[model samples]
Target: MVAPLKVGIAGLGTVGAEVVRLIEQQARTLSARSGRGVQVVAVTARSKAKKRKLDLRGVAWAKNPLDLANDPGIDCFVELMGGAGEPALSAIEAALKSGKSVVTANKALIAKHGLRLAKLAEKHGGALNYEAAVGAAIPVIKTLREGLAGTSVHRVYGILNGTCNYILTRMEQEGLSFAECLKDAQRLGYAEANPSFDVDGHDTAQKLAILASLAFGTAVAQNAVYVEGISSITPEDLRAAEELGYRVKLLGVAVRTAKGIEQRVHPTMVPKSSSIAQVMGVTNAVTIDGEGIPPITLVGPGAGGAATASAVIADIADVARGIRAKPFGRPVEQLRVTSKAPMERHEGGYYIRLMARDLAGTAATIATRLAEQKISIESIVQRHANGVDTALAKGKSSPVPVILITYATSEDAVYRALEAVQRDKVISGRPQVIRIEKN
Candidate 1:
């Protein structure tokens, strides 16, 4: 019988424990398939004795992850210690330099430094695999590089963050404000103690950057993806979106346009009946439009110990079988860097709410301002206190809320027109705005 493939684990956190669980759970089947057993020989974490449920009786615990990375007995280094830099970065670098296969679940490190690391792995003939980085429980990275190798993907996008998805789902379902949804997500443990990374759209942007790098054969430029959070979304905005036959979702969309790559993470108004809209709660959904692969949509759990470890073990299976590919499906030197589309260059429909005075000529003036900018309104639903337009008929000065859905338009024209009209003294509150995506 062939000798077993030895694996070393770093950072015994939630994911680390899951890795152990998976190794044990799938041991018999994995060994039968590979014709060689895969064993966890050692592990690393900050604590030598953190009372945990994961049985470490047969596994040796290493205080320093770097030592485990450099160990000759370990054929693969599985680094779950997440962070952009530090012991995780150092350990990964050392493992690659030593010509050992490396697997990681750190998107931040991959987003910020993927190009350099990919080059290093190639230089040493080592594999840099991070299927767990982009979408946990979904084999998207592998599906892109291997399954869709023959087809050219024009765009790839999804709701990449589960915390953000949970909050948006709650807001759409309960008509709750962003703050209220966030508090509920916190209690549900979907959100971290500090939710800025997820709620602020940075986490989705990072994952999008990573996917874009692989899809476009370019270095991951997370900073290029425009990010806008949903914190400003009010219950009124949710209701308006619903009335307009749309649902609000935080989308990380990437398109390879003729001009450049357009990557954006923001609150979007998708058609209510669209499949993406139906993906509620902490579930994640990704869509890819290719030349001949037929549009593919994969939806499942975005994060969790079991889901995340499923990705890690998939990569481990690759290592055990010696299956590997270029980190971005092409050599680093051959990768092309595409410029990101400017925000003002974007064209889309929008949901805009304006607070208008219940005075005669105010509606006409606003209509003229919109027409002057060629911003044609598709529908206008005017609201009154008693469901009567009598306040305006009586010439009484009152604040009337006007909800509008505009036709698709150019951003430059919208910016110029809104800038001039928003400064009007009669306009109440900053005009609440959210862009609509028909896809």
Candidate 2:
């Protein structure tokens, strides 16, 4: 008879606690599916005295994460304590070193030390699974690592962060400013007190690095991702997107190019008809474009304790079933080292918003600058100023807003044209540029 797979979990926070409850609740289902019973035998947390509504009658509490990880009775170690360094890192290492399978939901740690940890898992012959780290309950990791194993993937992109997506959704639907939506998100517990990690694109960048590795077979490199935040997005931009048949989303995109894989995170203008654009609120979506297969898009609730616990339990089930796929879909020794693709060389469509001076020569100067850089405009709209003729008749000057949609062009050319336009004194303030991603 197969013995129950004993599990030790570290950090009994929201996700960890839920994982324990689910293991007991789903024991029969898990055993039927995995061909073995799964048990949560040991656990540890920052404060064991902190009362949690969990049943630990048969469960033993360890002194700390390391002690729990090294416990001989457990067959699997689950790490829920999140951080890029310290106890989480050492504990996971110790667990792998002991030839025990490990599961975790720590994206930051995976992005930074994933290659190192993956190597340890390989050397020690134990499974290293982190299905919950990228997208909670989305199954994207398995899709890329296993489902598409026979196919060749060229592009992978998504809306990875819930907080940023919620902010953008509120701004587009209700015409709210970034700050206002952010304040409301914090109040609703969707955002942290220090929201820079999510809003500034770092969180998406980390998740992107992990996906890029799985899709492109490259070593996880968070620094390679070019990051731009949603804080620069404005109501006017969202309104313009609506009129232009597009929606603004904070997207993390990784695609193969002639030069190399390009990974970037920023507020992108996606066609309204695309699958990813339809996603809103705290939901998450990822689109993977393979060589021969049609694009596959996975969408689901990205966060919350229940959603994340679902993914963690799935990883544990894989371990119980004796499945040990490569951590990044490839052996660490075979993973290629990748660096940041230069943004100036990035080629794509661009949306440029300029505040032009309401002078006769301003329009002419702007056109001449763009022409000098060999940029072709797909469309241009000059928003009519309220009572502009009356203001001109009264001998006043105001800046007219001009929006331009450009065909395929280089990032350097766009910046050069905008810089020349700025130097010529034809526009007011800095121009806003958003990249366009087609379906």
Candidate 3:
């Protein structure tokens, strides 16, 4: 009989603890499916004394992550300790170099140093699976890496971060400001105290880099993603988007273009009718558009102990089944180097909200500038002046809100026209711009 796959997990946090529980609880099922039993024989964490409430009766507690990774008794190493550098990286590296399969849920590490670790896994003939790195329990990584291996993918985009999605959802549903929703998210343990990583779009950017690499067979590089946070998104923007038959979502989009793959993360206006826009709350969703196939959208809980653990266990099962596919869906050497796509060259419909001065020729000046840039306006709405109808406030000097939906245009042209409008003193404050992603 084939021996069970002995697993050693580093960092017994929420996810690691849940992984152990699932392995024990699902041993029979895992064996039946994988053709072998899966066991967590060894584990390590920052504080072993901490009461994780997990039953580790026969498990060996290693001294540190490196010790656990290099344990000869273990066949698979799982890293739950998150960070872009240090012990997590070195531990994963050691595990890969030792010819043991490695599983992890660290998106930052995967995005920044994925190519190097993938190379090590390739050279050493070990399976490197990180299905939980991008979307927890969504199976998107597998969909791109194996399921869609035969198909050519044109675009992959999604709402990758749960915290940002929750914030935006509450803001849209409750009509609360971003700050109020963010505080509630933090209180509910959805967002961190600093919250810069999730709110500023860095977390989404990291996840996007990983997905982009898998979809396009490019080397993973977090720096290549153009990131814009959801902090600047206001309730007014959300209202305007609703009126325009769209929903504002913090989306990470990577699509193939004539120039190259354009990867970006920002607050995007997706049509209310689109599958992704229907997703609300802290839920996560990803849409993959491949050649000759209808768009496939995978939606699930993007993060949490149970959700993330499911993906990790699935990856471990793949390792147990002796499935050793290329880490990034292609050989490391074959993976092309990806550079930052210039955002100025991005071509898409734009939703521009300008606080135009309530002057006689303000709208005319704005129209002239946009026309000069050859930007065709799809629709324009002069909403009101401080909640009062523009017509009623005849002599009010206060700025009136002007919302414009422009046809497909270059990002540079939109900015150029907005800059001219600002210089001509036709608007007040910086304009709020959201890219439109159609279904």
Query: Judged by lDDT, which candidate is best?
Result: 2
| Whole-model Cα lDDT of every candidate shown, in order | 0.85, 0.94, 0.93
Each prediction's RMSD over C-alphas, in Å, is: 1.9, 1.8, 1.2
lDDT of 3 at 270: 96
TM-score of each: 0.95, 0.98, 0.98
Clashes of each: 0, 0, 0
**Which lDDT tens digits does candidate 2 get at residues 189-307?**
99999999999999999999999999999999999999999999999999989988999999999999999999999999999999999999999999999999989999998999999
- In the range 1-439, model 3's lDDT, one tens digit per residue, is 9999999999899999999999999999999999999999999999978998899998999999999999999999999999999899999999999999999999989988998999999999999899999889999999999999999999999999999999999999999999999999999999999999999999999999999999998889888999999999999999889988999999999999999999999999999999999999999999999999999999999999999999999999999999999999888999898899999999999999998877778888899999999999999888674553343134556778889999999999999999999999978999999999988
Over 4 Å off, model 3: 386-394
For residue 262, model 2's alpha carbon misses the true position, in angstroms, by 0.6
Alpha-carbon deviation at 375 in model 2, angstroms: 0.5
- Residue pairs with clashing backbones, model 3: none
